[model samples]
Target chain A: DAGVTQSPTHLIKTRGQQVTLRCSPKSGHDTVSWYQQALGQGPQFIFQYYEEEERQRGNFPDRFSGHQFPNYSSELNVNALLLGDSALYLCASSLDRLAAYNEQFFGPGTRLTVL
Target chain B: AQSVTQLDSQVPVFEEAPVELRCNYSSSVSVYLFWYVQYPNQGLQLLLKYLSGSTLVESINGFEAEFNKSQTSFHLRKPSVHISDTAEYFCAVHETSGSRLTFGEGTQLTVNP
Candidate 1:
């Protein structure tokens, strides 16, 4: 079975532009979480979606938003991107919250470079 | 709010030598701890996690982490290392009531020949 998969392995955008990255969760999983990994730093959680609704969110601003479709795929949208927004965007999938263990499986991630 | 701190930013050690990566977290509520490893050009992979039960958890790859509630720490250790073990290690935590994970700055482990 395929693990989590992300689209557009790499992307480049100038400031004030908007970018959208996509991800497909692992088979049999229903939860998707997005993270931002800056150069030389660990990933910081952006948000998580369950049943097409956002269940949890991090300290990110309103410029960062996401959507989860019924098929369990997710899309992360960043508007008015800033230079600091340039980073690797990772998508992780896991089983539902009711499960005993929620070990997340991650995708290769989409590299977004905002100039 | 939960936060994680990986004490070492970089650690260099000879192959087959033992190593330890320190991690500490702060959370007001009960939380789950995790350790993730990232290789070049790869996403974060779960190395091990601590939810409940025994405080000591081991990974199939010989890596283990012990959760000390009193100390508010989860330290990763391996009896011996290999060159292929070189990678970035991250410590993360999430409240038991939530799903969002807070990560540390990360520790770079270099196992030399």
Candidate 2:
């Protein structure tokens, strides 16, 4: 069984440009969450998707948006990127919310570099 | 709101030595604690998690963590270390109501041979 997978393993963009990172959840999982990890910091939650809708969001701005397809895949879109936006975007997948535990499987992540 | 604090920024231990990485969290309600390992320039991998049941949880890779509710701490420990164990270990917490995880500063565990 494949674990969570992400596309465009690395990307380069300029200021004010937009970028979209894609993620596929683990097999048999239906929940996807996005996180940002800066150069020397731990991952920070951006948002979570469930039932094809955003269930929870972090303290991110409107420029950070996401979509969850019916197939349980998810996309993270960051608009008006700044130099600070250059970081590793991580996606994690887990079983349904009703599960007894919250064990999340993470993808290799997309490294977005804004110049 | 929930937050995690990793006291040590880096920990160095020789091979076959026992090592411990400290973690503490602040939350009002019950929480699910987790430890994730991230190699250089890689994604986070679940080391182990403490959801319920016994307070102590072990990973197949010789790492273990004990969840102390009263202390709001979930510290990772290993009896013997290997060179391959060098990585950044992160501590995170999730509220029972949702899956949002708040991560710590991360501890860089350096195993010296």
Candidate 3:
């Protein structure tokens, strides 16, 4: 089965601009979560989407938002981006809703560069 | 809130040598632990996980992690490494009630042949 897939493998945006990254969940998965991985650091959870609504969010600011479509695809939008917003944005899909036991399948991720 | 800490930022070793990567976590509630490996320009791949049962969990690639509740640590080790094993290793923890994961800073393993 095809695993999670993300669009626009790379993106470049200027400060004060907004960008949207897309992701298609793995086959048979419903929940989608977004993460931000800065250089030399592990990924940090941005937020999770279940049932088309954002269920949980990390310590990220309000500028970071996401949406889960009915087809289980997701889009992460970052508004008014700053230079620090440059990082690798990853999307992961899981079959479970809240259980931590469900393993997540990740996409190759979209590398965002804020210039 | 949960958080993970990987003590080593970089580990270099010769091929076929053993290696250990340390990881520690802090959580107020019960949590599940996981180790993921990321090769260059690739997504994170599940190495192994510790939910319950045995404290030690092994992966097919000869890597294993032992969960220590008292110490709040889950350190990963491999008996023998290969050049292909070089990657960034991440330690993550997730609360049973939440689907989110808290990850460590990651340890870069460089296995030279």
TM-score against native, each model: 0.97, 0.97, 0.98
What is the C-alpha RMSD, rounded to one decimal, of candidate 2?
1.1
Weakest ten-residue segment in model 1 chain B by summed lDDT: B93-102
Report the lDDT of model 1 for residue B41: 93
lDDT of 1 by residue, A14-81 (tens): 99999999999999999999999999988999999999999988899999999999999999999999
lDDT of 1 by residue, B1-113 (tens): 87899999999999999999999999999999999999999998999999999999999999999999999999999999999999999999978877888899999999999
Worst 10 residues of 3 chain A by lDDT: A96-105
Complex DockQ, candidate 2? 0.75
**Candidate 3 CAPRI level:** high
| Model 2 agreement with the true structure over A6-109: per-residue lDDT tens digits | 99999999999999999999999999999999888989999999999999999999999999999999999999999999999999999885765567899999
TM-score of chain B of 3: 0.98
lDDT of 3 by residue, B77-96 (tens): 99999999999999999898
For all candidates listed, what's the TM-score of chain B alone? 0.99, 0.98, 0.98
Fnat for every candidate:
0.74, 0.69, 0.88
Q: Compose the digit string of candidate 3's lDDT tens values, residues A29-81.
A: 99999999999999999999988999888999999998889998999999999
Alpha-carbon lDDT of model 3: 0.94
- Candidate closer to the true structure by DockQ (higher is better), 1 or 2: 2
Tell me the TM-score of model 1: 0.97
Error of 1 at A77 (Å): 0.5
